[model samples]
Target: MFDEKNIWDTFRYGDESSFKLIFEQFYTPLFNYGHKFTVDDHIIEDALQDLFVKLWKNKDSIRETSSVKNYLYKAFRRVLLRKLSYAPQVVGFSSPEDKLDFNFQLGHDHTLISQERLQQIRQSLSDALKKMTPRQREIIHLRYYEEMEYEEIADIMQLSVSSTYKLLYRAIETLRNNLSNTDFLLLLSLLSLKKV
Candidate 1:
């Protein structure tokens, strides 16, 4: 049987094997999460490298956590944000927050749903997602796609628990207003936190 806490403890104690396990498990998820912030794959890779490097260097001093994935996500996000903050300024981009432009698509599975209707829903979902602010998009992605809890999201996003809830509410409301009722219902089923 696999034991995540044991692995985390060993990694914190400077075991290379445990660190490899932790790295392999979280790298892809961390990469995908970082992609939501910027389109530059190189920057994402560099930030991920920096994150892992820092973690490895500081392992002996790191505290064991109840949720390893949450801790990694929170740490990686901060590293990625700091990397992003140094980019060239764009028009209307007054700060690092303004640089965030989150966009995502809905992937359909189930052969039962017709391709044409699926395409329509995907378009509608994409359109609705585009209407939300980057913060709203991040909250929704964490809450739905990543299946994160409000507290986890609040910690990662540096917001209060109620703030994460409010952000999700606004995001869902935007989707509800933009998508047809049928598509909205379909969305609920489509976003059921698929096991990865």
Candidate 2:
């Protein structure tokens, strides 16, 4: 298996090859994560560039990480949040003032699927997610849609491991309360597609 920690350690020791590998490997995930906060491609690109540039400049000072992905996520989150704070009308995932952007679109193919059923699925998923607060929705996304461990989610969200578990449980409970058995299963099936 590819050892991300070893690669991270090599990069920390000033290896430019390892640096390039990490940047290339993490760029897509980091970009998607940044997009959760803002739709602006420019901001997302700038934040990613700033992250890699700063890492290269300060590589020697960076410490070894047991989980390289989590470390990068934690750092990238801070930088993105700072940029989003300065930008007007950009809502962060934890922002309660803004309505939850819990998108649940089902792309249509030229199959025999009916539009009415697709719309119903979309509406139910959205309705279930909208019942939760933005913070709750975020925790659910990070835990399920992102397929992240509790520790990793905690590091990125700046929450404790226990808090991460509690928040995820609460978020799921809220969804369960709002959705019927069939709708909840449908929602969960779609969310679990990330693991596939």
Candidate 3:
């Protein structure tokens, strides 16, 4: 298995190869995480670029983190939020639903099942997710999709640890209530597809 601590230590030692590995491991996830907050590709790309650039520049001074993923996530969230604060109108959509941009894609074709059935499941999961409030959706994404710890999520979302757990629990409970057991299973599998 790949060890993040070892990779992080290597990068902190000013090894360019380790830095490249870290970037390759996290770029897509950071992009996806940022995309959940806003739809603007340019802003997300810029934030990611700034994040990596700063990481490389300050590698020697950066503290060793128990969870590098969590640290990066918190840093990325701060970068995006700070950028958005300067241009609040960028996310000035009237409703949380309007700001949502969740989409599900099937990884492969299923010969045993009709395409229509697959579509139905996909649609059902999407609908179920859409029904959630923006905060709820975010909590689910961080907690489930990102596999982040409650403390890490709390720090990123600016919530208390207890609040983070309650929020995630409520989001899962709401999703469970809205979806049938089979549909819930499909949603879980779909969300886990990319491991973030």
Candidate No. with top lDDT: 3
* Candidates arranged by lDDT, highest first: 3, 1, 2
Report the C-alpha lDDT of model 1 over 154-194, residue by residue, as the tens digit.
Answer: 99999999988888999999988888765666677677745
Q: Each model's TM-score, in the order given? A: 0.79, 0.72, 0.74
Cα error, residue 90 of model 3, in Å, equals 1.7
lDDT of each: 0.79, 0.78, 0.80
TM-score of 2: 0.72
lDDT of 3 by residue, 1-196 (tens): 6689999999999999989998989989999988777777778888888888999999879989998888898899888777766777776122356556567777586888778778876766676677776678788899878887788889988899999989988888777776786566667877898687
Report the alpha-carbon TM-score of model 1 versus the true structure.
0.79
Q: Write the per-residue lDDT of candidate 2 for residues 88-184, one digit (tens) a residue.
A: 6755544443344556657758277678668766666677676776567777777877899888898889999999889988988887776676566
Which residue pairs show collisions in model 2? none
True-structure Cα RMSD, model 3: 8.1
After superposition, candidate 3 runs with Cα above 4 Å error: 92-101, 105-121, 173-196
Candidate 2 global CA lDDT score? 0.78
What lDDT score goes with residue 120 in model 3?
A: 75
